[model samples]
Target: MTIATDKITYSFAEYLELEETAAYKNEYQDGEIVPMTGGTTDHNKIALNFAAYLKFALKGRKYNIFIGDVKLWIAQYRQATYPDVMLIEGEPIYYETGKTTVTNP
Candidate 1:
């Protein structure tokens, strides 16, 4: 289930800080932080299959393939999300020095 707080809104920085220690994945939209729902088994299998295929097809290439766990930071929308699969070619552009958040796909 997705959890959204209506009583209090959080700033982008505050959301990021809270997310670091959050038990579950949280999505930041504008100034609100919402908890993400866990995907079903079928979803996990599909994502894994896709990632495996990409890895095989792009073997020895410069592209990096990430599945489900990496955080994607979208500055224009002020949103942070975890996509099912992401493929980044060449070096990735990070949002912070921690290098845990990526700004480019």
Candidate 2:
């Protein structure tokens, strides 16, 4: 039950380019790239179920629920994470090269 150990290092510029269209998403942090693992079918089902419930329960609220491939940047730690579920409000953030900074989950 371990993620692959190919903790290859990448510069910020290289990371941005790699993220543009990598087959599977990679999480960037501390000058290292950790290949993301695909979740099981059960994981997908549960996530969808939760998302559906949240959407219905939060109808008319300002919160937005994102399912997958959404970037969460934590600028304080210079890392970026892709989370299973994220709720965000207001203008969205985009990584424009190294122009944008990120943080870990």
Candidate 3:
């Protein structure tokens, strides 16, 4: 389900601060923080199955497949989104020092 916001604008820094403590995930669009909706059971199953298949197919290869929990930081667009699936061939390029966010997929 989607979480409703107050419609007030926020700076990127402010958004990040709020996101750090937010119970649910939120998408950053420019300067707005939009709450993300949860996926259906079918969607979750599909994503997990796809990731599992990729892991099996790419076995012995140098790659990492992430499911829906990781955050993707798009620097150019100033957006942080959680994709259904993400694959990074090599070491991920992290956005910050803690290594919690990645800039490259």
What lDDT score belongs to each candidate, Candidate 1 first?
0.90, 0.71, 0.86
Q: Pick the candidate with the highest TM-score.
A: 1
Clashes of each: 0, 3, 0
What TM-score against the true fold does each predicted structure earn? Answer: 0.88, 0.74, 0.85
Error of 2 at 78 (Å): 1.8
Q: In model 1, where do residues sit more than 4 Å from their true spots?
A: 1-7
lDDT of 1: 0.90
User: Candidate 1, residues 1-105: lDDT per residue as tens digits?
Assistant: 999866777887798899889999999888888899989999999999999999999999999999888889999998989989999998889877867789889
Residues 1-105 of candidate 2 have per-residue lDDT tens digits of: 887876567786687788877888888787887788889999999988988898888888876777766777766676777777766664455555442332322
Worst 10 residues of 1 by lDDT: 4-13
Winner on lDDT (1 vs 2): 1
lDDT winner = 1
Which portions of model 2 miss their true places by more than 4 Å? 1-8, 97-105
When 2 and 3 are scored with TM-score, the better candidate is: 3
